[model samples]
Target: MSTLTHHKKSVRAMAQHPKDINSFASVSADNVKKFNLPNGEFLHNMMSQQKTIVNAMAVNRDGVMATGAAVFALSYDVTGTRLVTCGADKTIKMWKKDQNATPETHPLNFKPPKDIRRF
Candidate 1:
């Protein structure tokens, strides 16, 4: 058996990578961090728009991830290309990866929502 102790805050959720058994994600505060299996090596943080504690998470077969917080629930489409999140605000948001955007462009091109309603 192995143990992972990297999270500085309380871990609220966890999800294994659907296609990669060697890795998994854990949510602490507003950040989702990735870690390797068995070895417990810290991988990296997944990009997110959440500003509060994450309550649930899931990974689809195509590696797409969905995370929910507050009164939200998240899920991915069958194709794994789209992620949908429904929240307490009675709104549903869809997210998809921009194929044309590179890592360098992502930071500049990505726009966060102006307001995130939390319960």
Candidate 2:
């Protein structure tokens, strides 16, 4: 089993609109503008997806690296060997220092918005 799944503590969380992954001001602004569409779905996509960035990372005794959700909060065990993360998906994930914990993105397959007129 993966180190994350093997953790003893697990909890359900509430999803929230997380911060942007783009640290550079220009890139983040351009993206926000480029992706800001009249449709709400498009806006939501840009905002939530960026939160999947790796905020924290740790290397274990075996020298393997692991990461946590970027925009969300992070926690570590007393020894700093185990890590925990809360992401926009509202799930708290845990991983050992050696585990490769990466965020998975499920893209939204959406159609362009269509305007409706009154009959």
Candidate 3:
């Protein structure tokens, strides 16, 4: 039988998006915890809740990362305008709310003709 090392890192299973390979989670030397990939430290900053870490994590179709909480998951909008987190906290609030009335958009329109010229 192989012996487990004392310095072995404590890792939890993390769910990644459909086409995402990189996962992110909060980790630390003591109470650090989160669901992330076994390769990198992407969510190292979101750690330290003075409690337990999220249960699961996943990246949205839009490429936004989210963390599972006691009851719900905390995720960002496609535009990154607001932070949405839901859980046993029984609260629905935004960590970062945007007051801008309009979002950025391309003004130019690209319409192709039915008939195309061949080289």
* Highest lDDT scorer: 1
Q: How much is the lDDT of residue 65 in candidate 2?
A: 32
Candidate 1, 9-119: lDDT as tens digits: 778778788878898888777567888887889877664346677877878886756666764567778887788887788988888888898777766764655442211
Task: Compute each candidate's TM-score over C-alphas.
Answer: 0.59, 0.27, 0.33
Ranking by lDDT: 1, 3, 2
How much is 96 displaced in model 3, in angstroms? 0.8
Candidate 1 — number of clashing residue pairs?
0
| Clash pairs detected, candidate 3 | 28-32, 72-87
Cα lDDT tens digits, model 2, 1-119, are 21212112232221122132221110121121112212222222122123333444433333323334433665555555777777778788876633443344434564432431110
How many clashes (backbone N, Cα, C below 3 Å) per candidate? Answer: 0, 1, 2
lDDT (C-alpha, whole model) for all candidates: 0.73, 0.34, 0.45
lDDT-better candidate, 2 vs 3: 3
Residue ranges of candidate 2 with Cα displaced over 4 Å: 1-71, 98-119
- Which ten contiguous residues of candidate 3 have the minimum total lDDT? 110-119
Candidate 3's displacement at residue 92, Å, is: 2.0
Q: In model 1, where is the ten-residue run with the lowest total lDDT?
A: 110-119
